[model samples]
Target: MATLPKPAAISIRTVGPFDLGRLSRLHKSCFEEAWSRSDLAHLLAMPGGFGLIARLYEGGLVAGFDAMRGVGFSLCRVVRDESELLSIGVAPTWRRRGVATSLLQASMERCRAIGAAQMFLEVAVDNHGAQRLYEEHGFERVGVRPDYYHRPNGERVAAYTMRCDLEARCGPSRGP
Candidate 1:
C-alpha cells in the first residue's frame, strides 16, 4: 500500500474584516480571476459567513521568515443546518504541502460547531486533484453546474458539486 504523505505543521485561525487584504491577495494568487478586498469583506459580513486563515510554521518560522506566514484560506457560510464552502485555496508555493487539507479540516469543524449537518462545495471539473482531496475527506459528487466558472478570457468551465455530511465526516467539534 502506498503511504500518504504527512502534512506540514500548520496553524489555522478564524479571521475577520481585518484579514480582507491578506485573503484577497491569497485568493488572487490561487485563481485566474481574483476577488477584491471589497468582495471578500462583503462575503464575510453576510450572516452565517466566516473565514479561516492557514499559516505554515517550520521551526517557529514560515518559509524562512521570522514570523508565521499566511499561506492559504477557506471561506464558508452556514445557513440553518447546511453550510457551503465558498472558496478554498493555497498559495502556489504552498500547494502539495497539506495547507489545503488543514484549511479544509478546520472549515468542517467550524461548520459542525455552528450546527451544520452538511457541507457543500463546487470544484472545477478539470481539477481532479481537488476532487480527490474532497473525496478523501468524505465528500461525494452530487451534480454538475454547467459554465459555473467564467474565465477572464471569456472561456467557461463546468464545476462538480460535492457534498459532505458534517455529522458523519467531521463529527463533533473539539474546543479550540
Candidate 2:
C-alpha cells in the first residue's frame, strides 16, 4: 500500500508547492470564470506565485475547503512584484461563515511578509457584495478593465482594478 499525505488540518498553513487540487476547486467555486486544474498546477510549479487554502475541520473529514485563488494565470517567469488577486473562492456550503474574510486576511499577511507593495484584484463591477467586502478590507478602485469578465448572460462584464497597499494596510494591525 502507498502512504498518503495527511489530510489538511483545520487551520491556515502556507499553500506550499503541494495542495494544488483543493486550490483549483476553490477557484472554480468562487469565480464565474474558473480556471482549470492544469492551469493552477502550472502556476504552483513556478516561483514567486502565491496561493493559499482554508480547510474545514471535522473529526477527520476536511469540510468547507477554500483557497485565495489568485486571479492571474501565469505560465512562466513569475516575478516577485506585481498586483493581482488571482482568485478567491469558498465552497458554497461554507458561505457566510467568514471563510472569505479569513482567506483574504491570510493571503494579505503572506503577501506583506513577502514584500509585495500592492495587490490588484478584478471584481465584477456589479458585484456589490464582494465590492463592499473588499472596500472594508482597504481595497480601492483604481480603474476599470472593461469587458473583463465572462458573464453568465453570455455578455462581457466589466471588472475593476482594485488595489490595496500591502504594508500600509497590514502593518498597523501588528502594532505601533
What TM-score would every model get versus the actual structure? 0.90, 0.74
Which residue runs does candidate 2 get wrong by more than 4 Å? Answer: 1-10, 16-18, 58-81, 172-176
- Tens digit of per-residue lDDT, candidate 2, span 19-137: 66666666776666677777887766667666666665544344344333222111212246544666666666566556667778777766666666677788888988889878988
Q: Write the residue-wise lDDT of candidate 1 on 89-173 in tens digits.
A: 9988778878888899999989998889999999999999999999989999999999999999999999999999999987774
Q: After superposition, how far is residue 2 of candidate 1 from its true place, in Å?
A: 15
Q: 12, model 2: CA deviation in Å? A: 1.5
Q: Which stretches of candidate 1 lie over 4 Å from their true place?
A: 1-8, 60-66, 172-176
Residue pairs clashing in model 1 are: none
TM-score of 1: 0.90
Candidate 1 colliding pairs, count: 0
